[model samples]
Target chain A: MFLKNRNIWLLAPAVLLIGICFLFPVSWLLQRSVSEPVWGLQNYITIFSKTIYLGVLWNTVAIAGVTTLLCALIGFPVAYSMAHSSPWIRKVLIFSVLIPFWTSILVRSFAWLVILQRGGILNDFLAGIGLIAEPLDLVYNRFGVLLGMVQVLLPFMVFPLFSVITRIDGSYFSAATNLGATPIRAFFRVYLPLCLPGLATGAMLVFIISLGYFITPALLGGRGDIMIAQLIFERIDEFGDWPLASALAIVLLVGTGLLFVLVNALIKIRGRGI
Target chain B: MTKTTPKGGLNRRTFLKTSLCASASLAALSIGTRGAFAAVDLSGREMVFASWGGSYQAAQETAYCNPFTKATGATVIQDGPMNGSKLRTMVEGGQPIWDVVDVTDTFLAANEELFEDLDFNIVDASPLDQAYVHAKGIGCIIWSYNIAFNTDVVGENAPQSWADVFDVEKFPGKRALRDRAYPMLEIALMADGVAPEDLYPLDVDRAFAKLDTIKDHVIWYTSNSAAQQLFVDGEVGTGVLLNGRTFDVNKKGAPVDLTWNQNIRSIDYLVIPKGAPNAEVAQHFMNATVDADNQALMANTLAYAPCNPAAFAGVEESVLPWLATTPENAEKGFLIDAEYWRDNLAALTERWTEWKLT
Candidate 1:
């Protein structure tokens, strides 16, 4: 009935625009993944048959998981502090965290390359103080990937946590304290539980984003830390094997989507309990 | 898709190259007839040329783009770091946006059928010597990859050869090499005493074996940006570098110096997509890029030398030494066997992967 009363043609241009722009290309990519026109299943077949593809997938998941965990570990405390800090302090903290997000992620990844390179500023400082004989392997390795990924994805965690934490009534913390709970107990019991949804959402966003990350790992990661996006990029660009690259891309998309759904389902279950 | 014969495939490769040359020259002749295309006012037609976007963007605009508009009249667009992935998308997507593309030497033969036969007719090949390719216009010019060193780091006494790069005991500090294996293997072999000319028909196993000798000392950086930055930061004393990036870094005050003593060169052809809307225009644009004055301007801008041997005429003698195409450098530099690299990289990449991690 609402559709009957509406001017549907108003939505036609935009709907057609999106469908033509996005859906068709995405469908074509997926189609290539499964059936390379004549070479049906060859692309998908190659992915499973090759150990390198499997290694890449594992590296993607491991890097994403570790980065997500690290973002949570680091972000939660900052969010907690900001949620309780003066409004001015909260604004300042949020602004500072949000600043890196404004710059391109590729630029930020290169910055990490500068900081973590062997004989880089960090290593130079360490060696200057007689900390070690040789500058350690810092960039072009797993450690550099983590440092870059976490830096790029940190705001995604911190922002959402701040939103959830900000909504909690101070009265709940006061009431728990009035009931003879310790300040720490009252703070955690009242504040942290309220922030779980945002925390999960932040973690899920960071995880999904990191799962498809290409640049940071490509630039920073050593041989073992190669990610799926880089594999897809190479398959298409380097090897010119479009069908296999498309297949790898579709698998990555499906995997990321499934993980997002799973995380959302968990969030929903926790939402009900809350 | 690979098969080797009883003293195999070399003859077939030669035959294919010859046939390709004949057909390309024929097409180039017909397109060379300027009056046939003179009436087709290109003012309304849009063209996009993909090149490595940087100072190249400026050089291309002034050299090819503005002059093309002034001469024949057309809208020109530029894109770049062209590879097969981007080409596949443009072609297979059925929306061929680019009329011309400047691809690396490696991509030329690998995606063989995707490109339109270059018209020798329209493209002014005068600047290119007969010896340019053993055959001209089959492929023309592509930017080269060379090892750039920090002059301040090396000081007055610099390493002349790849051997100096790997001589940690002699020219000591930290050393950097490109993370990519192509030049790495070649340099490693050279460092380990393989003759420059004997470097290809590459001995992959021997190259990797030599790479192993310097494994602990090599701090490999992947990106050219990072490779340049490492020198900028004074992180590593020396590294293998891209020619254009080295110049850019030196301009940015990184105190870097480059040696073409044993550089590997890859030739990129000016070719069109099979379905390019403006194939004739693309060929003409190629000529504009190769003109002596334009070539000199492009060299001054990007430091990538034009393949047109004659284009160097107008360039000053003082600046001639730094140009990659200068005989002093070009004679010494080996033209990269891109076909060999195209075929072997994946296999060597697999081995390199295992070697690095293991």
Candidate 2:
């Protein structure tokens, strides 16, 4: 703290980059939201009053919530195994999780369509095996959207849980079991609670990322699965309605900010309790 | 003709002047036998030509841009899979990289201010249909939302109308439709028994009601490429698709085909963006797009109907039936109302989203 005069200059380039690239554009967007189509809160008013905007907002949150829940459920066991397994097994697990991440979201979404559409490879294979007489509706629905999003977002959940679980002492669970608690009871009471911070971090990452998803939902989801990002794109691309688009973006930003603050407060409260 | 300027300092105007002088001498020598581009020679100039990339733009390059270069001596640099918002931003920033951009009629109608007015002296729109010509742009191709189907899926019972497409019992299975509001509303109304001529200031409530009946059956597609794939793969039995997109898949031996009944025609326009670096060359490029021979080549390759009526003479016999503007085909369909869409796009699109959610 005493010798920080020159050390602060090291932050100069990053600060300058953020100021020019991010902060400037964000502030400009903020200004555009209010100033366009007459200087008032008309854009925000329209967003709030309109059922279309409100519905899409609800859809975005609902989809993100479901996606986060799914990632957490699927990621927990895999992450637990990765953390507890031998070095070679851990390497294999990490590679499997990360290899898909390297592929573009657009390509992955298209791949899902190829595999999951009604006349796709899955249905053909299933029909060949006499699993069913009729092809099932797979892609182009809420289910497909979840499947696509969960696969892409699972890594965000797993890595955090893996790091946290590895750091956790194995004695916490053994101690609970020695105190006359059953294995399941000991795991739930001692182990799960200890993993909460990592779970919260991963959930936050997945939920927030899912909230702004565009390509996966557009490609995989049904008509009703339109999200806020898609709406923003349509406003700008189709109509060139920047004011409304900017207002929608600001709403998303503010909503995510509030959620983040709420989660931080909850974590602090839990810390105090402990 | 042999005059040389000082090395390394020839600006655009000076180069144009030098070319003009050279052309003047050549024209004088040729006397009464002046070729088509006798007055103009853009030998040293170059302009960027932007369009929706893929086979469509590739066909345009072979048909329009190449010929324009041959006639005018200006190089046309190909760019873009044209995106609307990016074009708007580029023009608003007053430094558009693209000189001539291929845009839809609706986009041209909505954002007229973003484009340069056509220099009538340079671009001759006389050969084209008057309806296709605009003050800010020239119609390059006329395509339509057609009642398309996979022959394999529908078997012997082919869908001939929008009503049949809406009739699940008639043509059973999942059907594809565009995810936009403009044409969807129009399509829904037409399916509900509204006449083609009567589809103006559209009956919105009635359209939604019609759409609701087939809501569960529809596979809404945002991209035309995806729509083509759907038809090609026999995933959709019958639905609405663009005429050119249908032709592309069908040419590749896909079982897909289309009907001309109640097709909704739309135009793609080539416009010079405001403050474009080579607006002069772009204006001449527009003239080349209207040439009968070039337009015929485009129609032959893509089956996107040419705006120039004379281009039909050079069109192949097989491609004639697929074209939207053939006399018999033209009588069966109507152009989409770009003005109405320009006014109602935002409001109705919101309503569309609300309807979908419900």
Candidate 3:
């Protein structure tokens, strides 16, 4: 009993911290969703009834989904290569990925603005090389938002996948080779299946963070790219509508919770298959 | 949930109760400390003056705070980029940190309950424009939103009117407008041929219809910095920008020029938040700020016209045309209806969001 309870005792500080800081404030905010401006579920009803609110909700989800997929597609190869590379090469790759994490997101977003704006370096370079006659509408659009989000979030996906991949035993690949399988075949048949857990974890982390993104989307996106976080800020700052903002927050919280459950279920099913 | 308890020691319930009491007393002690300070005489007290930062705050320090501090022997500290939500939070919490805040007149009108009514004897606002001064706020500065364009990009052909801004075929480049509902609706109405005097009780449908023509061509800038960047980076050919920001950029040798034609004038007011620790000192600060000479100095420095009409008399002859309140300039611009915005901001903002998304 003592041994089993020791770990629980160790977790008590974290539990207490979360309870006081995160859970308390969030629950208070959730309570305000129903109680402010009047008592009822009217805030929720209003959210569902208005197409604009629903549209931004859908926009947030869609952007998150695409950003997750792009990050996974780009990060998997980079993380995989880093895991399999020589030690010096691996060190260089890790350093490059972690460098962006050290810089502020605001600075990076503005850097992207400079690179992607019309008559900016990218456009000027492309035009100079005779690649295109006109500067493409790149920065203040969905493309810019996705580019900035993926760049910022790629490190999140890479680190987790690298940690998991490094843990896989090297003998597995050797064993597969001995069984007359090619390197590619061995990777798909063995390494890929083993990496699923890490892939899921990284994808889930990136998706959740992207859902709450405000600054990058606001700075890089055009008129049609309003996200849920920006909408909540507008509600609070422009209208002083705390109740409605709280309600929107609650919706995001519940949606994130649902996504967590769904991802957990899928991971469990995959775990069973493995 | 149980922890190992020492023999003959306090139970969990007793421990929790004692700790709760201790924390409650700690909070009370903090509030008590603040109350003790507030009960003292106003002389030598320190007060916070909150306003939009940058050259604006620097100008205030020179024109308002410095003189007030010299006369009253009170220390004035600067804070903030004038956020409405923070003001509401501070006032509602009953421990407002800001003694005097510079906020849009519309914001003061909307959140009147959070402000203290001004006493005319304490805060002599007689030098200010009577139309802008209210019981809850004193007029601080007047600025206009004008058509600002990059001179390097547009050359000799600058946009002269809102009609030119909306006519993409004539100008043929991206334009930026403030993301907020105000002034944009007014600009749209003017572009659609509605006279300035008839703009109040805005025809929302007509404005939105006119906006649709240039909606695709328009990029939205939510802040002054963003609007400035839009022009400096050559991302937009023209944008609606605050007169002060435009002036600052032009002074910095950025190829930006402003057209005073049909600009929209906005007034910022100095208001005291309710439950301020140094409300009386803040009132004196307000009184000192509105003196004609101080107003003129601030106007000269920031390029935002002073609220005191008499300040114009002291202003440099070369600067008069640039002042938003100058007779020639004022006639070319329409005053934004603060009352209309205070009442309809929420509904209009909702529609603005919907329209932006579309």
Candidate 4:
């Protein structure tokens, strides 16, 4: 839009930087991934034929699905509470939601690892209280992975839902109440309908992100809980099998993205109908 | 924003200095290359030796860097944990970053393009043996991965052998193992009755079965580093790990012991990129690296035995028991068949994943 001399001159530098930093590396990575192996789909085929890889993929989807569900369940209520509260309460609640987000994800994941590890604080507390005679297996399991992921990704779901919830008019609920609707009935007709968009957006964000999560699963999950990201990383980092890793990455992107898009479309249609 | 040196002035000064530095750097680079196979006096030139950045790595720099610089005039710059891919990129990108890398022989075997061959003519090769040469002295250094246990956790009924490591009833505590499948599987198989000598041409099914028995007791580390940290954290009573790390805990007064009866020994080597600009200089540095004095310095810092046989003369007798290459240590442990693994890494690693999870 700006055809001015200074602005036109700035475009050259901006384009130069973007081309150098982003385009060059991505192009090289693409070329390497496709060519590094036997130049065909051998690496990609290996991903499907490989039972371990498929199992890891299945576990990754399962963990992401569970995490997204948990985030939605926990986040929905908080968003509801904030939406119904006074402005002061809403501000305080939002601040609380954001407090943990400021800390590093690594720190948060490590904190959960400590709590969930065998002989960790949680196990010690349980044993001390005579709840169990021995420390139960906790960390390095599916449970630990879920716990860490839910903590890291809860805010992603909550905030988007909060935005939509806050926009829901109190008048709509009051009118439904006045029109012979019970509190629960009024909420179903008004609150649920109003919060649909935010819920969809938040759920999609969480699901898509959970698909790509690397650190939490690797750190917390046991051997059986290996995820796609870790597998892709291993292919490239450990084996130096660039083509295979790229193929894995490509599959992950396509599979996770398609599922997310399909779900988003379904939700959008249903929300519109409601 | 106020009165300051103009853009032209700044550019001119920068240009002049950069040109001077570039010429000086070119001359130094050429000199190092021309004397590639010769043991040139390192007294004036600064040399950068790369390593896996850690405590022992720090010791290597302290013991060798300062002393080597003082005595030889080679200002040593210690860099890195070995990364073959990253090094390749640097060499390919037109700037050679590291001259000497402290990497494992396994890595050199897997990624042969990343390191310069040792100049055996100048670098003393007399200390190394037939087995070591066949193993490729630069690709991997002779090192051990052994069984370690917390003395306090196991008490008087300490693990006599790796059989003791698997004895849940005897050594009753969480057992940790490195996340890798290579040496760990071998340890598991040995515990399951496979002779160490017969471990070559690995029996996949038997190895998996052995691993399965301890899967319940074994806390397999996804991050190898986590194995040590877990033991140090007192979460695990017993584990199989790199002897160096297990030794660190013992040195630090942790109640731990290393069982080398069935320890795995392998070499980690050094190499130059296939088309590296610094290949010639790298070869010179490699020559300096394998020198008896320098290799001895590496041993003192790393605790892992030095590759140069001559370096053994410098290694103290007190440390001989721990060095992987000592006649005592070498007699017990067999060389890791890297060639077999090199041929079957892809297939076997896939099997390793299934075995670990299953």
* Best-matching candidate per TM-score: 2
lDDT of 4: 0.69
For A1-274, candidate 2 gives per-residue lDDT tens digits of 8438858988889999999998898899899999998999999999999888899999999999999999999999999999999999999999999877999988898899899999999999999999989999999999999999999999999999999999999998999999999999988888998998999999999999999999999999998999999999999998888999999999999999999999999988986775
lDDT of 2 by residue, B208-325 (tens): 9999999999999998888998888888999999998888888889999999999999999999999999998888888778766678778988999988776776678899999999
Between prediction 2 and prediction 3, which has the larger DockQ?
2
Ranking by lDDT: 2, 3, 1, 4
Quote model 2's TM-score for chain B: 0.89
Candidate 1: residue B49 lDDT (0-100): 82
Instruction: Report the lDDT tens digits of candidate 4 across residue range B1-358.
Output: 0111321232343344335434322211211111122224555565456777777677666544453343334666677776656765675576767766655655666766554555565444444454665322352246887777777777676665677788788777678876677776677777888887888788877877777777877677766566776776678888777777776667778787776677778876655554544444455555444444455556666677776665665565566677788777677667777777777777777777776556
Instruction: List TM-scores for all candidates, in order.
Output: 0.80, 0.92, 0.91, 0.84
lDDT of 1 by residue, A41-87 (tens): 87777778767777778878999999999999999999888988998
DockQ of 4: 0.37
Candidate that would win on DockQ: 2
Residue pairs in clash, model 2: none
Per-residue lDDT tens digits of candidate 3, residues B1-358? 2222232244454355335434322211211011111122356688999998887898888877875665456799999988988889889999999999998978987899999999776766655678778898878889999988998887798989989888888778799898878879999999899888999999999999999998888778776787898888778888799988888888788898898999999888999999999888887777766666567778778788977765665576767777889888889988899989999988898898888888
lDDT of 3 by residue, A1-274 (tens): 7647656778789989999998998998899999977899999999999988998999999999999999999999999899999999999999998888888988998889888888789999999999999998898889999999999899989989999998999899899999999999999888888888889989999999999999989888888898999999988886678889999999999999999999999889978887
Between prediction 1 and prediction 2, which has the larger lDDT?
Answer: 2
Better of 1 and 3 by TM-score: 3
lDDT of each: 0.71, 0.88, 0.83, 0.69
